[model samples]
Target: MKGLIFVELMNFMEEQFGELLTDEVVDAAAIPGDAAFTTIGQYPSAYASRLIGAAADRSNASAAELCRAFGRYLFCRFEVRFPTMIQRYPSARSLLMHVEAHIHEEVRIIYPDARPPTVTALEVDDALHVVYRSDRPFAHIAYGLVDQCIASYGEQSTVEWCEGNDDSHARFIIRSLHRSAA
Candidate 1:
């Protein structure tokens, strides 16, 4: 995984849990490179899982839930750092459709070693259906990103998650409805 991810995770921990808890999580994680993360550096993904597990224990939340929340928070951070990426798409569905084709391609250009998840979208019964596949299990995080994307568009949306037969793959159905219409 990219060190930028760890850096952002640390930022999320501090902002959401507090400085003391964030420090505790990082210190307890026993991460390689002593948590001196550089945005361009790469680290083992297991270290990230450890940090998330520690944060989950401290917060009394499931690791999956925390990961998803972190994803949502990360989206806000991304918006701040890369406004053009989010601004170019008028809808969450549109953004999702281009995640693999556009966003991940840009990521590859910036950090050639980064292994972003594969995201594909299809339309079904007026809902945006997305399938997420990766060797690393971060479906909850993807869910959070989708949730925030809908919110960013000022749309009311419901995201349903379905675990794939393979542990590393997952599917999401996002249905957006107008706030007033609902």
Candidate 2:
């Protein structure tokens, strides 16, 4: 995983929870790297899992919920850090569609060893269908990203997600809703 993610997760914990809780989570994680992280460095993805698990244990929140919240924060971080990458898209659907081919590709070019999820988006009936396949089971996080993406466009959307036959895959179907004529 990218250290940037770990750094963001730590920041999320510190700000949302507290500095002491952040240290506790890191300590409970007991992973190799501990809490040391550099934005441009890489570490085992499992460390992130442990950090989230530790936070879940302390906060009495499900790991999925925590991951989803982190996803929302992650999207906001991207908006501030990489405005051009996201601002180029006119709609949430457009951004989701290009993630695998464009965004991940760029990540690979910049960090050759980085392993990111493979996302593919298609339109089915009236909804945008997205399939996310990755070794890491973090679809809840993806769901949050999709939710915030639509919100960022000032559009109302509902997302339904289902796990694949296995943990390595997930499908997200998002339907745009008509806002009331207020």
After superposition, the stretches of candidate 2 with alpha carbons farther than 4 Å from their true spots are: 163-167, 179-182
lDDT of 2 by residue, 17-113 (tens): 9988888889899966668898898888888888999999999789888988988888888888778889999988899999999988887897888
Error of 1 at 176 (Å): 1.9
TM-scores of all models?
0.92, 0.92
Q: Quantify all predictions' global Cα lDDT against the true fold.
A: 0.83, 0.84
Name the top TM-score candidate. 2
**Backbone clashes counted, model 2:** 0
lDDT of 1 by residue, 117-148 (tens): 89899988777888889888787888788888
Looking at model 1, residue 79 earns an lDDT score of 88
